[model samples]
Target: MKIHLRSSLLCIGLLVLTACQSTSSPSQNNSAKPHEIAALFNQSTPEYKPETEANRTDKNIDSDITSDSKPIVYDDLWQEVIANLAFDIVPTPRLQKRIDWYLKQPDYLLKVNKRAKPYLFHITQKIKQKGLPMDMVLLPFVESDFRPKVHSSQSAVGIWQLMDSTAYHFGVTTDEWYDGRQDVLASTDAALDYLVYLYQRFNGDWLHALAAYNTGEGRVKKAIRQSKKQGKQGYFWQLKLPSETADYVPKLLALSYLLQAKHPKFKVPKLPNYALTSEVDFAQRFDFSVLASLTGVSKNQLHRLNPGYLQHQSAPEGPHKILLPLTEKQLWQSEFFQRYFSQTYTVVKNDTFYGLARRFNTSVNTLMALNNKQTTLLKVGEVLKIKKAQPLDNLMLEYQVSPYLAQEEKKPVLTMEHEYIIQNGDSLWEISKQFNVPVKDLLTWNNLKSSSLLKPGKKLVLHLPRPAKTPKKPEPKKFLSELEQLVKPNTSP
Candidate 1:
């Protein structure tokens, strides 16, 4: 009787488990599973529809997260970034004074803070990467006020205020493709590295090193000597220094203090954390216009990301880089940089693939690639196609694309013509030797009939040769008779 009771109990337990499983996931039960049935029984479950799962997956697949659906402008991003920035840990007295100066200068103060906040955040992000202090970003405001194209009276430029020599020393290029001085990101890296060097050299006394940055180590040493002579304590402030150097560190500190004190008054924006996309080499000198034309991006867009470029074109300097927007870069990759660069023009009767290549300043091989054909054979009436001219690639030594005429690689003849403004103590002989042009040519070019008189701002065209066509119509024989008389006089004599 007891054995019969236990069998009945087992049967009852199996029935209960099956009931729970079906209750938990009735929609998921194509396969018979005991545990699944128990889970289904424990909770009220939403209907599991295969159609809904398929739809959800499809929705995720169709979504585009790389790019914004709507057009995004600087103003939209600027507002958020500026509102979130805060500066709170400055304590140097001179720095506080400088901060006071910044806060008081309404025109400079408000404009720089607003424009600089985003770039500062960018700097901070990079600093965080190297485990450095984020406050260093504020130093640029004192250096250049976040201006990308400012040239100092002392000859520093860009946001970091790097001198040309210093930039080159740091391996930053000053070619047509890029100017490290004006590039916000590159300049920041170089500046930070330089500062790190200075900090190490000066035993972490940032003030003395910063002063040395402006006035040089020799000047700083002189200041130290002067300070010791006067029996002063501490390093920079107690020492006598150049006015610019005296104020440099204080200026940095003041801005930091103001940001700390008035962070709420300051508007900081949030920048999206964008991963670097593609780093394709620009093996040729390329114009920013070409990138704009090819990528369907505006020149303005390129400028914002690449401020270091002094001009519209990039030096196809090997390793010339462009940090592209992720989605745009992806699109170009998908097309293998072919869509915009793949433009086609058909050959006319006068067309040889060589001629087409020359017209576009590309090679015959490149043209062949465009047409997907091998061999230079041409039919009298066979249609041929070619890529468009790309001058940007001209800067690259290896750029194979060229018009057939350009394949000959005509070396450029650089002719420099200068207009010499007569200065306080200058002479034609001196000017001719200085410019390496013949004195006779210089005088003739300028028509300097008077040997000694050159007024200031007088336009003197030098180094010009006489035209092959004619010499200034020789004082048109004002006298046909005089001319005859002068010729006949020789016979009379």
Candidate 2:
């Protein structure tokens, strides 16, 4: 059976925590296996409950910042936040320098203080729910800077930076509508669970566990073996590691330093702890406005709690959440759940099943089920039951393609093209020479004069030669750029 997490950030607050009783192994046996972490939880006779809540601080611990209403004094809390950032994971000088520079950036510090709490809270709660070390929540800062859309050079993505294979094993699907990697709450649970399992395998050594996170466990084991052969301790720092892993711990340490008391040393801002009231469940796709109308929450409040909704909408098939002030939970449950689906719309043009499905903040499969159809294409003039007018301006950001395409030989590769800014003293002539395009053709293509110098941030499109084609009849122009035609030289008729 498919386990669906609530996709919408609507009203419901259902956190699915299945206890594992250890059926078989996570190893493939021609049958789909439960995630290893889930399997482990299944093995326990009684579900394991973390003894302490992750984000709770002793009220008496320092009450320096007033209750939720008051803004935290940066100078007051920077020292504490930095001290709390200590981790055994990373330890490099270059990483230290990076953290220093990162903390010194005023804009970044402000964002960190303001936007990082929900992320911190989500991860910290997952850590506590799974009994993980609290320090691991800081990992996202290094991984994605708490940005949900971060895609790494190695194709690892999301805040926790899971690769496709690992994400699959951990139950994150890379489907058209959902990339579980970018789902902050889901990915945090998966990552923290993975971290705990790794920590157990490494005898609770966080260093080795972290190395497993950076480089796969198999490779880390190999490095440990080599370290032993060289009469070195099998510690992470001593083991031969990938360049990235070698720098990983250092980066963590640097991050810790930046969050430390010397925060002012880097002019770093202190982050305040955000208090969440409650998470309520909305079992169907609904618009943010509906949430506002139902729970008396403003649209801004809902988005603030659920920033992972990239298009400012929820996913389909009835698993959305609307985190609200605890006091509003009953108000939402009493009024919203029974009457939320009334603000519906009929399907219109440019509406694919998925597009309409997403527009309604529901799933394509759900729409198919709702309409009794199999394909994603919708019949023209088909009446779609939309929750709100379709969002015209903002769609999912087109996935970025690197210089190297992931798939082989797609047509019109320019769709993945990116722009390189022209720097000071750059000219179209120099650029064409650098990128190996003819100067006259480049000038004409970019609409530049012969004497015009390229300005910074100018967009240049590099056209790759297409396949050989039949020669066109010669035009009246003196000559065309060779790139315009792809034909073999003719020797004889």
Candidate 3:
């Protein structure tokens, strides 16, 4: 009965794919069509595999169970990874080509191992929990070479190489102060969720899910439909896909094969099967410098573990968790540690509980509770106990950091000339607040008197601070003197 149901769904899926292909014109580029089909798949089928005793049975029973009921232990994580590989692929030229490419670069695996050491165990454990094919653990190797802070030309960031839209769709947050896409814990959860979603969307085809991950589900479904139209099986290998995507699945498969086979030419690096880092949850926003000082961990190590924090402090609005060395977990959880890290804020003029709540990314009720205040009213020059801490500049530069954070830290503040057109309902004071400039400064910049009448649609010259510029390397070029020297060499001694 189960087999029959699966067969029926497969036939329906094929029919839908082929029918969509038949109706679509060569010039038709409607992006909505693919999503419409995806929506159909979502509605027609269960989003997850049904739980059954047989399917729920652990596949790694050998290593996971023993006569005494104690699980067998492996010293190396790669060995554990090898024991659980579930995918089988026949060696083809394309697969061999990828394997050959890796074999030629002997140092590539070593570098990957170094970068992967901190996160691999955690990622592998997550895959195991999900009952996914173990090869999914290596997806980051192909995506970003295990670099969490890496960015692609397409604006994809992190080890998972998730684009902003996809990241947001999967609940990975991105903002000025934080980017969950680059957080190993956050991105891993989001990436795995997306993969599981794709797996179900493609009717349990892992290859299709992986290919879709590279190009997108829309394009992969379109390719499958085109293949079906041409009297093909519409399998991953048979479907016509973009060049990068065509190679993407094969590359992963080739790596999986090599790792499982333990190829003589290829050497796998030794990594412990235990987690190298653990998450430390905070009830409030914390400063990384203070974290470094309290935990005796270097700022560089903290930055590496918590790259999602764009500045020297955690996001004002946050998950409020940091990945730290497992050894330091005890230190972070100490009661004294929490008390020592408590921060304070002084109430200034025009400061209200509501305004302070928004500024500090907390709630007025929490503030009131902390201060034992009955009302939202606040006194000037009052000291309020706050959870958020301002970053110290001296501590921020104490150690080298990731390029992205370093760029953000050393970002320049430049003033640029702007021509603003006067709009309806505009006032000098309002414009000054809008641009974060004083009204007097605005008048001087525009060459206007205090009594000048504002007219709609009229241009006003204003000087405003420019956005932070990403530091770029100066392009190499030859000077005119060098060019002249090259053209005519001096013969004199």
TM-score of each: 0.47, 0.50, 0.57
**Residue-by-residue lDDT tens digits, candidate 2, 305-333:** 65445334466652365566444335434
Query: Considering summed lDDT, which 10 consecutive residues are worst modelled in model 1?
Result: 1-10
Task: Give the worst 10-residue stretch by lDDT in candidate 2.
Answer: 1-10
lDDT of each: 0.50, 0.51, 0.65
In model 2, which regions exceed 4 Å deviation? 1-108, 258-263, 267-278, 287-318, 322-493
Instruction: Put down candidate 1 lDDT per residue, 1-493, tens digits, no spaces.
Output: 0000001111112323333211111112122233332222222222211321010000111123233333123333333222222222324444556655655564555566555643554565444333233346667766765767666656576778887656654445565435676767677766765554454444444566678777775678777778778875435557777787777866765554554455454343344443333334566556665666656667677766676664555654533566454444464444435533445454456567778777767898977876778787666656555554344444323335546534644432222234567776777777878877887887786666646586766657553321233111122233222223212322444
Write down the lDDT that model 3 would get: 0.65
By TM-score, who's the top model here? 3
In candidate 3, the residue pairs with backbone N, CA or C atoms under 3 Å apart (3 or more residues apart, or in different chains) clash, namely none
The sequence of per-residue lDDT tens digits that candidate 3 reaches over residues 1-493 is: 0000111111122223433221111111211232333333333332322222111111221232334443346898888787666665556665789889778876667778887887788787655544456677889999877877766656677889987666665556776667777788678866876675676667666677889899988899999899889986676777788899988877887787788778888878888778887666665677676677766788779887877777667666676787776644454455434445565789899999888889878899888988889988877889998763333233233335556555545432333345678999999999999988999998887779989999999867676663455322222232222223222333789
- What ranking of all candidate models by TM-score puts the best one first? 3, 2, 1
Indicate the TM-score of model 2: 0.50
Error of model 3, residue 228, in angstroms: 0.6
Candidate 2 lDDT: 0.51
Candidate 1 accuracy as lDDT: 0.50
Off by over 4 Å in 3: 1-71, 328-493
